[model samples]
Target: MKIDATLHYALIFRDMTTEIEASKLVNRLAYEDSLTGIANRTYFIQELENALLEKRSIGVLLLDLNGFKQINDQFGHISGDEVLKTVAMLLTKSFPTPHFAARLGGDEFVVLLDGITRQSQLDESIGFIKTKEKNFSVLLGEQSVPVEFSVGGAYRENGDTIDELLMRADEQMYKEKYKDRPHERNSFN
Candidate 1:
């Protein structure tokens, strides 16, 4: 039997397309958070390392959710899951494209933006983060559980190591977390 070349080519293309879609699905599952649907820690770290290797100017922002444990204890794990999902969506919306946002497990999340060495861009991103308090809450059962987060950010410095940047951001986050202290509010500067 003689095969029609056009039909054979079309069949091959259809099979290729199916394989491509399946591969994409697998990638998403591997790299995405099952609950919040954001990138997982592995993907986030990979991106950060890639940025560092490429010598790109970037800023790393870390956020630690406050009262999350209390909420989980008082409410339920399901409520906590809802809060995480909500916060993930908010970060995704706030830092769309060229900027990366990921859930680094539990209540810790990170946002990476390129060109943060530029003062205007850095200020704008930081301003948006600081002003996002109004959008961080989630509804749990009948009560509204406010999802509060403290943010710490560090810009890439010349010859800075990944660990240093992470530590700086983490330290800033700690200060933010303890902003109730008289001297903690301005510690990041």
Candidate 2:
């Protein structure tokens, strides 16, 4: 009778541990992007909000791939997914820890760089991206698919909210995304 009671208790503990692990896996899947294996948009926004609440000086970067639709149309989604993964890899390698990158579905990605207390820091990041912007290319069959992107960076203003910072960075990104192509993405039918 004693051994049976002990065995029952051990089974109960095992089941409890399994439940805890399952819950943790579910929580992680909720915030992780399936394709690129980076933080999804929801998680990224939460982190940004947390940073703002902590009053951390941060540089918000919005990156939009230019002509992404064309790439998908020409190379199918496999090539597109490959390009997206490549972009995520570069962002992770470029930023490292504390600084994070997230995918906003489709071809849009966002990066948050903390500890940008000076204008020089922002400028240096801009320079780095400008230098590396042309280096993203993927070999797709016989043709090499070039991954072109436009980046916008904005520093937090006094009493600025996350939405405002995102808007500013997005506007800056659009400026570059539509620099020469006045046709734009939405009305290019």
Candidate 3:
């Protein structure tokens, strides 16, 4: 009886340790961004893949900062970093819940919209981003400068990979840039 009790306790301890380790792994993957603190490309891709595999219709918005080179040229790389951070903050605030946002790299950001069953919800989200209040200021020498973004979005369909979806969204973003706008650029500039 004593031997059986000892074995039972040992098994339970091992199981508990395994559970704790698994939990830690998940938390690490979910919370930490591989590149930036916003979110890692893997996390974004996993979320997108889950949504797609679940047959849940969703929207992907890819945003690239136009005139980012101008900011870097005029101010410096530090100012460019400020712009990326500010834009990341804006994206986090804009799509507060139910939407996953991440920085793919450099000046490119992507948003994955889950629980979007209707086209109107997608439209509303797009409109919200379009008219979103972005009042970020950067100190350039002695003066403060402001910046804005031109965004584009695409809906996810069947038979789509992560790259395909992002490319499609990027294409839409570039199309939006082509429209006559003050803050718009020709491409992912």
Using TM-score as the measure, the top candidate is 2
Worst 10 residues of 1 by lDDT: 6-15
- Would you estimate the TM-scores of all the predictions? 0.82, 0.87, 0.73
Per-residue C-alpha lDDT of model 2 across residues 75-120, encoded as one tens digit per residue: 8999889889989988888888889999988899988998887768
User: Compared to the true structure, candidate 2 yields what TM-score?
Assistant: 0.87
Q: Which model, 2 or 3, shows the larger TM-score?
A: 2
Cα RMSD of predicted structure 3: 4.9
lDDT of 3 by residue, 1-189 (tens): 268556433343334888899998897777556445688666788788888888788888888777788899988898788778777888898887888789877788888887666667767777787776355565666777777666777677678777787787777778776677636453364
- For candidate 1, what is the TM-score? 0.82
For candidate 3, the clash count comes to 0
User: Could you list the CA RMSD of all candidates, in the order they appear?
Assistant: 5.5, 3.9, 4.9
Error of 1 at 46 (Å): 0.9
lDDT of each: 0.84, 0.85, 0.75
lDDT of 1 by residue, 1-189 (tens): 348654443333334888899999999998998889889998998989889888899998898888888988999898888888888898889899999799999999999888888656765776788789766567788877677788888888888888998998898888778868757546674
**Highest-lDDT candidate:** 2
Q: Give the lDDT ranking, best first.
A: 2, 1, 3
Better of 1 and 2 by lDDT: 2
